[model samples]
Target: MRRGALRPFRSFLPGPRSMFYTTDGPHGLPHNPFMAVMVPRPIGWISSVDAAGNRNLAPFSVFNGMPCDPPVVFFGPSGQHKEGGPKDSLRNIEETGEFVCNIATWETREAMNASSALVARDVDEFELSGLTPLPSTLVKPARVAESPVHFECVHLQTVHLPSKLAGVSALVIGQVVGIHIDEGILTDGIVDMKKFRPIARLGSSDYTVVDTIFSMIRPG
Candidate 1:
């Protein structure tokens, strides 16, 4: 298959139905399906430090890579916390312009969930979750020691999205200045998914793990 080539997907299911609704309108469902529809999103276990040098760790489901030439990635924090402010991760990134993106895996799921608790600005999630923090070479924030992969990033900018709700959401974009990968997960020089065993977010409190692998060559 050539680049930009189209592949037909044949489905035996019924044809699509009109179930779309405006963002401002109600979907008539018990829970919004937006997050569920974007199933299995990569979790960015973000670590940062405040001006006072207090470390902060949090997991953002709305996170992913943005570019490759400069190796960029981003995580978005939506809504204000119970403290009535932006998340500590976002605030710390703004304060110091540095952060580390740690890849969350099945083994660290519990710790990840614990770190997501809305704690105070001075609180360190590493200690709260009982996870070890490894010093980063290129950033002030420490990387999750249990995580197999880490991206030491320098904050580039934050884009705030207009929202109808009281609180706004922002995307924190950063340039990956350094990366650490565990050699144990490498298979023939490539990171093996089976060994990595990464976990991802789903709707509500649901999560899924990556235990299976398959590949297909792109058409050229």
Candidate 2:
């Protein structure tokens, strides 16, 4: 296939009439299709420690690398937790101003899901998820031992998104001060996706693995 080619899948069943609704109102569907359409989002397996030395780990699907220079990344935590407050990972980063973004992979999918459980602030998610905590060189928050890649970041700022609801969503931006990559995943000094097999978040409870890959050179 050519680069950026569109491939439409035709269905024999009658499709629903196209409808539009403002985000402020209900989507008018059984389930919101917004997230569903934005598929294969990279999972930010964030780990952080609070001021009181409590460790927290959680996965945020709204995460991505901001830019290459200075190495920046961000993760958005939407809505309120069951405890009626920001998530532990967000709260800890707010307090300590440090975090580790561990890459999630197919091998650690179960542990990654386990870490997302809503637990008390004092609970150690590393232990709960049965994942080893690897000490970070520059950050207080430990990296997931099972993860092939880790980015030690310093909190830059948190941008709060406008919300009509009582609770607010925030984008936590961080400058990656250090990076760790497992040599095993590198082929000829380049990171190999086939070996890494990183997992991504889909809509609802679904997830996807990087099983297939293709490359294209940018047009001059």
Candidate 3:
């Protein structure tokens, strides 16, 4: 087989006619396909601390890295909290201006999902998730000890987007101030991501593991 070539499956079924719908109205599917269509999104396992040092942890699928020169990252919080305020991760970052992005992996997948539960403002999700919190080098928010990689970031700014609900959605951006990488995931001083096996998010109670990897150099 040629590299980067697609192989046909015996049981493959051809999809029907493409269905299109406007955002103004429903698509008529039982569940929204927007998130599903955006497959294998990086899971932002964010950790932050409040003014009073109340730590918070949460997972958001709407997250990704942006602009490598400055090393920036962003995550989206779609709705208001259950108690009618910003979610703990957003609220804490707003208060402290610091957060840590812990890489979620198959090893800690269950604990990552557990931390996403709606909890009180005073709740410590690290404790709730049964994950050990290690003091960060440049931030007050603790890092997930088991995670192979961590990005300690300082909140740059937050942009509020219009939401259908009473409150607005938040797009939180951060500048990476510090980074940690486990040497075990490195090969010849380069990141061997297959060994890292970061877990990614999908729609409707689904998740994917990034164990398979390939690389291509850009044309000069």
Candidate 2 similarity to native, TM-score = 0.90
Candidates 1 and 3 compared by TM-score, better number: 1
Superior candidate under TM-score, 1 versus 2: 1
Name the better of 2 and 3 by TM-score.
3
lDDT of 1 by residue, 1-220 (tens): 8888988898767558757788888888777689888988999999999898998999999999967887999988888867778878888899899999999999999999999997776788999999998998977899999999999999999999987666658888999999999999999999999999999999978999999888899979
- Please report the TM-score between candidate 1 and the true structure: 0.91
Give per-residue CA lDDT, model 3, range 1-220, as digits (tens). Answer: 9997989677644567768789879899977799888988999899998899988899989999986887999999877778887777888888889999999999999999999998777789999999999999999999999999999999999999877766559899999999999999999999887788999988889999987888889979
* Candidate 1 colliding pairs, count: 2
Q: Which residue pairs of candidate 2 clash?
A: none
- What tens digits encode model 2's per-residue C-alpha lDDT throughout 1-220? 7887978887766458666778878886766689988988999999999998778899989999977789999999877767788878778899999999999999999999999887877789999999999999998999999999999999999999887656658889999999999999999999999999999988878899999999889979
Clashes of each: 2, 0, 0
